[model samples]
Target: MTAILSMLPPDWREGTFLGRLDLGEGPVPVLLAGGTVHDMSGAAPTVADLVDLGAFDPAQGSVLGSAEDVLARAALLSPVDLQCIKAAGVTFAVSALERVIEERARGDADQAQAVRGGLEERIGGSIRSVVPGSAEAAALKAALIEDGMWSQYLEVAIGPDAEIFTKSPVLSTVGSGAVIGVRSDSDWNNPEPEIVILSDRHGKAVGAALGNDVNLRDFEGRSALLLGKAKDNNASCSIGPFVRLFDAGYTMAEIENAKVLLRIEGPEGFLLEGESRMAEISRPPLDLLRQAFSEHQYPDGIVLFLGTLFAPTQDRDTQGRGFTHKVGDVVTISSERLGTLVNTVATSRDAPAWETGISALYRNLAARGLIGGRA
Candidate 1:
């Protein structure tokens, strides 16, 4: 309830949103409609089941209270439960360049600036303008290869295939107002603010939420194979506030033009701000979704993180060393439609351990007598 105004969508009453709320007992699916919060656990115990049900009529459940009242008292949770957390990387030209910088620098923060300047000068324009997988992209690829500047990151950036990977475990993501972690050993790390799509089992986007894909540039820069370590960590993934379901007033088109804003306020008076315009994304969100769902199945649904365009290069403390997170830094990611997701940074070693899994979720649901079937 602290700074509650900044947490929910500005148009909370107009936009139909879905989220999980824990009012002491356990996490349950909740719906915000016409400014009222409805307990959806009676209709569907989990948000994933609610998605499978394909309907969010408030009339189907008992009213908890007004949105303002409920949100103040209940603990907000990540919008999706039981869904695989997946993310698309290098979907934006700037992000692609940043990845290249990380790669060329070999995760060494001191070498980033030098590598970035030359990399951008050589290929930034083409990467920015050429459509991915297009003939122009292919030509650019051939040209880069000829010049010996081709990279694995470039292959995913302009090549036919996109970079999609499992971001974290199903129940591991922390919600808004929680502590997001960065590995203590990582010398270069930052948050990747993104628009996460909540999709059904068939890969159809149902709603969207704000997400922070906490990234460790140094680890992945050391080796592409280190991506798993660079990304997944205790309290690494932060999502929500709420999932704004697509409706007449808000749809995919709104998301396509959403300008995501990021602000980092550090304890030592360090402040950094940046924005990611979805309009500049090299690949379409739906296209990324298709690549993610190509041959895999998410029976319980999936939350796909559309890659970020804002890659922080601003100096945090050192003269030439790029941005990196510090403990106690408050990171905020927000957009007009998705409201705000705010979290304070902490080292992964110090953050709370993830103890709950799918089994615990089912047991809790059964204990409440809410797990049998959709009502």
Candidate 2:
């Protein structure tokens, strides 16, 4: 458990911590370091109290004050609001597989070819998207057809409106929080350790931190037409503890090899657990984000998820009906230096049941893929 300090400059035992906190009014940016906390409300106020505050300047700095001086009983809602988020596209092969399985469950016979084309058009080659594949489209085609895991992903073709390899970063609004409130009983939710970077006005990644890029599996199956339904939801996106600033001297490649781990638990036991590196990711984080920023604007600020690697192929423990996340499943996504984002599973409002015959069938197939157990 190396402290996050190692990721910052040696002179400062801890880099200036920036995030949002609830100080009665609502959520506002705040800083924590050396046993003290500073509020940034005077600079950028809450989303509800937003005014013509110009632009959110992370460098405008914070107002000096102690948490006790303000209110000792205040909740720590310190992860600052990034005006927009560019939801990551398929940056991992495993994720691609997950989408394919989802379409297959939806009864797409050409799912494999569709997924393969997405790999070529949206993700393949630096000229197109950031999930770099060979310049020779044939190479990617060969790999998809020859690789067993990939072959399985292509069993059903991707729908015309799939979100796999779109060059631009997709807009998303889920924010930082401790609870994930899905909308369905069959929400196949999984947490992945994602490194989120705050973009400068020019779209360069100014800093990074640990993130939980929550995914709801049910939506990916319902339709490939749009990802907003599957990926974006209330309290689904979260990042925090603090942001480690990235100065010009430092390069995004420095964190490219960082280790990320995912862990999920129900009353029964661990459902998903594994470790992977940013190196395993096909899309370059900065490039993926830069392209996304090229089209979108965030006067306040924006957070970009790099994408996920490993996740359970199927559902795990539950009370009775085999919906993925139960009422109290705990999920922890972590980075040794950046720390962890732990959240509890809960649902928002009463929702219709989606774990009917088809969902169960897909879950069983995914579970069978892990027959020998977790790798």
Candidate 3:
């Protein structure tokens, strides 16, 4: 049985049923409903399209909820709706209005148009926020990646928020290699807490093990806003080759036998920190992210991020409003995943004292005539 609905052009709204036939095995009867078969190989025509052709009887299947009820439960409703549609069969009826929405999003239209239209209608208004691609935007994005790091850095009068400005000559410190560490503070505040290098890949820890949140406090004494910090360096974030998850596919079960170690040599090539177990961390490594992007629409051979960690540190003598970052104490983060992320002790690096890198980018863009008109 097929549920026919008129959707956008190019058969974007039509759904088809697929059946499997065995030539030599004497009449194999495996019929797949709510799914479309493009050719003899049962391949889907569009990668993003769903195969919901109405195969099963909802009456026969377990009746846990209404059409609206189920829809509410499956909030995002892309792949999940596909599963529900296939399972419900003839007994389940979906409002044509509901199916139109799904079709529009997954249709053959351009991605930008689809996303913009959907957000406007679904979220009750158009998006009016305009931000410059300046340093401020960059800083805020970096701060949001974890929880407390940004706030703490801002509080201590360190990082991009610091008032000092001095450029440091690019120095060759270390080679491109992997390093692992843990969140040393029970809470966020300390910058670059001692990192204990782990083995290549071995060992395990629970309750927010690598990829956990390291919380921090920004404007600690003055405001209620929260911030966070972690070793967001490209090398600091490490992960095992594999991950174990529950059947529902939302929670992490356990990290099976994963260990990490590292050795860091100082200015004279003397060991600064060496041979320590990486028990837990606030974020996952770049390699895992690379694998995930590969499975999706990411372009091939894109290096995700550069190694750099910025945390907040306090300065007692220089507590004032509208502070800026300094050069020597600032940590410049450059990543393939994220663009140049620069943070310094409040007094480092002499640039306009903007609140964020996004502002800086916007300034650069405006100067380049990218914004189309004067702001």
> Which structure among the candidates has the greatest TM-score?
1
Q: After superposition, how far is residue 53 of candidate 2 from its true place, in Å?
A: 11
Clashes of each: 0, 16, 72
lDDT string, candidate 2, 199-290, tens digits: 65557566677777666666666675545655555555556656655544334765688888877778676576777678866666766676
Off by over 4 Å in 2: 1-13, 43-72, 107-133, 142-177, 247-251, 314-323, 350-375
Q: Would you list the C-alpha lDDT of every candidate in the order shown?
A: 0.91, 0.52, 0.21
Model 3 quality (TM-score): 0.19
For candidate 3, the per-residue lDDT at 185 reads: 28
By lDDT, the candidates rank as: 1, 2, 3
Candidate that beats the other on lDDT, 1 or 3, i.e. the better one:
1
1-375 in candidate 1: lDDT tens per residue? 236446877788898889998999899898899989999998888998899998689888899998778777888777778999999999998999999999999999999999999999999988888888999999999999999999999999999999999999999999998899999999899999999999999989999999999999999999999999999999999999889999999999999999999999999999999999999988899999999889888898999999998999899788899899999999999998889999999999999888878888888888888976432
Cα TM-score per model: 0.98, 0.67, 0.19
Better of 1 and 2 by lDDT: 1
lDDT of 3 by residue, 1-375 (tens): 001111001221121212212233111112121222112112221111111212222222223233233222221100110010000000001111111222333321222234334433532111112121335545544653453222222222212221111101111011111122222322222222211111111111101111111111221222222111222211222221111111232122222112222222223322322111212221233222332233334111111221112222222123321111222232222211111112222211232222323344345335544344453
